[model samples]
Target: MQGPAVFIDLTLEDQAQELRKYFKSLGAEISQEKSTKGIEDDLHKIIGVCDVCFKDGDPNEIDAILNSIVSIMVSIPLDRGENIILAFCEKLTKAPDIPLARVCLQSLWRLFNNLEPSSPLRYHVYYHLVQVAKQSGQVGDVFYGVDQLKSQFAQCPPSSEQMQKLYRVLHDVLKDTNSELSSKVMIELLGTYTDANASVAREDAMKCIVTALADPNTFLLDPLLSLKPVRFLEGELIHDLLSVFVSEKLPAYMKFYKEHKEFVNSQIGLNHEQNMKKMRLLTFMQLAESNPEMTFEQLQAELQISENEVEPFIIEVLKTKLVRARLDQANRKVHISSTMHRTFGIPQWQQLRDLLGEWKTNLNTVQDGMVKVAQAQVELTRKQKAAY
Candidate 1:
């Protein structure tokens, strides 16, 4: 099951000849042990004496050869063919043509599908797939690869070290593009270590909280608060900091920072200005929920910002789509139409119930009106018929 040694300077014909020779020898070895003579014959026919590999052979000839190799790999026992197939697929991933590399990667996925769900080899193949996909710079491919790895990790829990490596890879891929999904994966990763290593779990949980706080698009902090790792930090400074972000406003965050300047600077490692920007956004969300129309002065007082900073701050919050509002510069007022809640709990549930009840009552009133109108029409029709 030795893979062919393809030299860089070899011509396409030479490369095809080397590959065909290697597959023939390997197929002979496999045919002696198993009844794969038909598959080996098909491999030779598909490759066929490298006659397709002329000085100006079609580039697709290489693709056809690779696909044929994949077919043979699928036909053979995984224990016999896995390493050889993986080596060939791994080498093809570095091919200059991206589409060719993608085809090979897809071939690997097909091989992966043939593996048992609990096979340790699945992790290795999936890791290689993710790296190749990352190198290709295709976000969709990266997502698909990561999602596959995540599924495997769930089915068979990995070591804490392995989980940490996965967390880093997932964080790097998704931190900027998708904060919500990143947070969710981070939480699940942390959950794996809660019983095994509490300290590591707490550290990773704090990291997740800091990441979520730093992300402007990540508005919901209540979910992070429930993580087991977060509970480990219950009496710690970072935990209190998390609480501030969840339910408190700008003044509370500023006061916390002022009280624990050293901890905030050294341990948290977040830019103070950026933190204030986020806090202002959250404070605006609270204000928007409570008040439909807030004057510039009211906003400045609550957000602890200057009058000049009010509009820009509001504009930044507007960009998050967390609140829907119109600015009245002349009237110095922000007229809020709607706002997203930071957390949904019993109070939010009650509000929803009340809203539903109101809608139901309104629907009942409309139904009664419709019934009375129908009765009146029927009575008028009957009176007209009797008079006639």
Candidate 2:
């Protein structure tokens, strides 16, 4: 909303083209107004005056003004999705001023959520919408956005829906991998699950887990059945992304692509040689479960590779710490230790949990045995004194 509304009257068909300039200037500023107070002030002034265009004015004139604002929001993005939702929320003090924008936002959100997880929009709009919900500071709204995503994922078409959903979402997200943004948004959403949490994205993610797990046929029966669902999405998506990197068109940054190509020759069974590295990465992850202590060299040795070749490969594995290492300085061996396997290599948190629980149980058992042994010793001493 801009100009004196006098512009609305001129309607010089030729100059109508320039009318968009006013909205563009304001649209540029929209990303800067983050907080509610900031958005409210600008929105108030703009709408207060812009309302005139809508007041008893021609429908097309009204639409033109509003559409300019809408168009900017649609076209621009901080990463993906409209960059202006926070600004919208900031300035949305007047319910009447926002009805149309809110409607459009909701509709757009629904459309993105309904697409496959591998959908290009997932990396674009759906991903951004989650961030918007986080920025909105409204728990219900954040979760609502997340729910739309989870529901779409959960209701994936029968047979191959799960695979397709992951397929659609993973590529773009991997391509546009601004991991900082993804990590921040996920942290914010996860933190919001508590009463203090206002992010709607977090709440909705929780709801999806509850609903999806309840239906055994559609969703995979796995660890996601418990408190965490992200575990499933992360591992599956990563494995898929690795597959893409291993493709003939290797990503520009893959330094070891050639070696990875050679190493994967026979390790990956049916997973084509193109997908060999990916399969090995995941296969090694699978191996970690049983022999968590095994080193990359040990794994390479299992594949009958030279100790010299093993060193460079281990350097790569060392970066992720997927396998722990120890130097056999004298004999020159590296070991992984113990994997404690699962669908993927076990997450550290799970191990911490098991260790803590076992510690408590062991302490209790040790205390009980000590108490019984003390009593028996006391009685035995009493009998020995009497016999003497």
Best by TM-score: 1
TM-score of the candidate numbered 2? 0.32
**Which residues of candidate 1, in runs, are more than 4 Å off?**
1-72, 79-110, 113-123, 144-168, 176-180, 191-200, 261-266
True-vs-predicted CA distance for residue 145, candidate 2, Å: 10
Q: Which pairs, if any, clash in model 1?
A: none
Candidate 1 C-alpha lDDT tens digits along 1-388: 1123222454333443455564455442222222245444433443333222322334566545554455455545556544554465456556455554555466456656655676656665665665556555554554544465567656565666766776666766676667666776676677666554666676678778878877767778888777777888898888899899999999899999999988877778777888888888888888788899999999888988898998998888888889999999999999999999988879989999999999999999999999999999999999999999
**Tens digits of per-residue lDDT for model 2, 1-388:** 1221112333232232343344335452222222344332343334333433433444455555644443333333324333244333333322233333343334335434343454433334443443333333332453333334456546332233332233223322421233233322333233333333233333334324322222212112133323232333344422233333322122321434354544333332222332444334445555555563555456664544566766665566565565565555365555566442334225657878899999999999999999999999999999999999
TM-score of each: 0.71, 0.32
Q: Model 1: what TM-score?
A: 0.71
Best by lDDT: 1
lDDT of 2: 0.40
